[model samples]
Target: MKNILLGVMLLLAMASFAQPDTAKWVRAFPVTDYMVDISDSIRLVQVELPEGTSFKEKQLGLLKGIYRDAQQDTGTIGYGRCHLIKGHYYYFTINHKQSGRKPKAEDLLYTMMDSKPVYNGAITKLASHFIGLQEVGGSALYDRYQVFLAWTKTDENNVIDSIVSDINYTGSYFLQSDAAMNQQIKSGRFAGKGVLDVMMATGKDEVFKFLEYMAIKPNLYAGHEWKVAEIFATWLVSGAPAVIKE
Candidate 1:
């Protein structure tokens, strides 16, 4: 009996070590269902604000949703953010040292305003809710122009509840690791080796032109729609303040 128990403990220890580290995987992607509400037709427009102005200060009308993405290189630096309010898309960027000086709120620049959407449908704003759930998985719903995510291993057998549960599982994990993602922006192994081909093919190139401008390889994983979902989840959390571009 003693020998058998010791063997069992050894096996359990080995199994624990064999388990893949899913934390990074979970952070790198989203776990949710993205469905566009067709009746929700809102024209999104890009807007510019003077230096250091708080977007929340502007009565942008109920603050529908928001998204933030940013990165930097040696010479040029960029921070981009998007706000959806009352069906209007107000997007802007903060370029560090674009004029070869210190960054100030007044130094922000607004890029070209395209009618293109930062996302295809209404965004679900879930903040720090799903950061602890394990056994997560994700996929793209290109037909809906969105990504789908759910638990890979769960006892909940009901298909409906399983679907509903994902509502709160947006890409909060991604934002939680903003520092790591930004570091990857500069020195990721997959840096700029054509990881953005699918993204570029989807008419979303302008959304990430900062990567091109800085000559850094886009560090996002393809098909998972991590970028889109990160922006999607930012809507409700009201998101982080613009950081100085590295």
Candidate 2:
């Protein structure tokens, strides 16, 4: 009887050691029908700021989420798919009359007002929010007219919650890592050597504290619409400000 008891105790101890570290696969998406393990293809861990968290804790949390994808990036040179900051987006659209023919470089006017310096220092304003640029249309001889520009706003100080949403992106994780990596590689050298892509290949998805994914909202003519997309004035960058050239 004593020997039986000892065997049962040993089994219990081993089982306890093998238990999962978490109860849920992740918090972004929860399983209702069945339980999910951490090894599942779609796993997310959502962390809520406790009610009593201090200001320092909040700052630390921001820093952690910003650098979550850079675990392997040793250099102080910070870079990532989303180098967020505190700022607000100031929306604008520069509409020029393009009769029928494709516009020349100068045809891309920045303002409609002549009474005052409507577009004074507009290039600097545009550059402030510029994240990157891409040629989206097909053919150099034909439909290639407009370029897409992305940037974060730098006018107001705001947090992540005010910026991103699930409508944009969920910080692709779980089993979607393969698809994400494939898309990155397809972008050629631009993303072939991206820091986020490498992290995805190794199954390292970061917990998005507030925002996820970003894209430029272009007009039908592939130009900036009358509205401007807003972002905060302050942001976190892995490196220097990025410039998107035409």
TM-score of each: 0.18, 0.20
lDDT (Cα atoms) of all candidates against the true structure: 0.24, 0.20
Top candidate when judged by TM-score against the true structure: 2
Off by over 4 Å in 2: 1-169, 173-182, 186-246
Tens-digit per-residue lDDT, 6-78, candidate 1: 5334432322221132321111111112212222232222443223222332221111111123222111122
Summarize candidate 2's per-residue lDDT along 1-246 as a digit string, tens digits: 355335334432322221122221100100112212223222112222122211121111100111123332211111011112223211111111221121121111111111211221222122212222221121121111111121122211121221222112322342265454322322322334433333223211211210111222111112222111112101111221232335
True-vs-predicted CA distance for residue 171, candidate 1, Å? 28
Give the C-alpha miss distance for residue 223 in model 1, angstroms. 9.2
Q: Candidate 2: minimum summed lDDT over ten consecutive residues — where?
A: 23-32
lDDT value, residue 212 of candidate 2: 19
- Prediction-by-prediction clash tally: 8, 28
- Pick by lDDT: which candidate is best? 1
